[model samples]
Target: MKKANVAINKDLCKKCAICVHFCPKEVFTIDQDGYPLISRLDKCTGCRLCFLRCPDFALEVETELDD
Candidate 1:
């Protein structure tokens, strides 16, 4: 399976929780600071929903093929 790296740009993020709500694999969670946390990276399917739905362009999902 391909592995995905999820990065959240804290500077750009507005704590909107859109990524947390839209992820099909439930890859994110709301942190204490109300920011989206990459909680389940292994569950990520690289579906790009979080990245595409982020209104602030704060989420980035990168997929790497496993050897």
Candidate 2:
């Protein structure tokens, strides 16, 4: 929980709700400008669904630590 698994690429993000809808954990929400906002990082099970579902590759999640 110390590190944020879901990283939003502001430049790559077109404010699309793809990541939002794709997340089963309800971890994402639409911002004022319709950008994908990671509302619940704690709820994230490190599921890569949001990352893979994102057509723009705007979101990424890391469940495990790197060796």
Candidate 3:
């Protein structure tokens, strides 16, 4: 299985932490600036749930190509 990546676009982010709460696997966390960070990358199931639930479309989750 491929490892998934969760990226947060700081420019568009509102620092709402919505993506942090929406993730059932706790894939995200609030940073010092209150923006979302990938807290548990290994826990991610590549479900893209955080991105889908983001209201500002600041977060993006995708399958990473194998190296």
Candidate 4:
């Protein structure tokens, strides 16, 4: 198993749903304001889909091996 962490920069993010849509694990959801939120941090596989798909470069995903 692995542990993953996700970070989103609200400032850089233009409220685009790319990260939300790109995430395979459905780790993100949209807030009322349409901003991205971490819905399932534990479910993240650290595939970097959100990070890579983010045009604004607002998303960061890090993974660590579970010991």
Q: Which candidate wins on lDDT? A: 1
Candidate 3 residue 62 Cα shift, in angstroms, is: 1.1
Computed on alpha carbons, the lDDT of every model, listed in order, comes to 0.90, 0.78, 0.82, 0.88
Error of 2 at 11 (Å): 0.6
In what order do the candidates fall by TM-score, top score first? 1, 4, 3, 2
lDDT (Cα, tens digit) per residue for candidate 1, span 1-67: 8888999999999998989998899989999999998888889988888999999988888998886
Cα error of candidate 3 at position 42, Å: 0.6
Candidate 4: worst-modelled 10 consecutive residues by lDDT: 16-25
Over 4 Å off in model 4, which ranges?
none
lDDT of 2: 0.78
How many residue pairs collide in each prediction? Answer: 0, 0, 0, 0
lDDT at position 50, candidate 2:
82
Ranking 2 against 3 by TM-score, winner: 3
lDDT tens per residue, model 3, 1-67: 6689878889999887878887888877788888887878998888887788788888777897555
Worst 10-residue lDDT window, candidate 1: 58-67
Model 2 stretches astray by more than 4 angstroms: 1-4, 65-67
Error in Å for residue 12 of model 3: 0.2
- TM-score, predicted candidate 2 vs. hidden true structure: 0.80
Task: In model 2, state the lDDT of residue 21.
Answer: 81
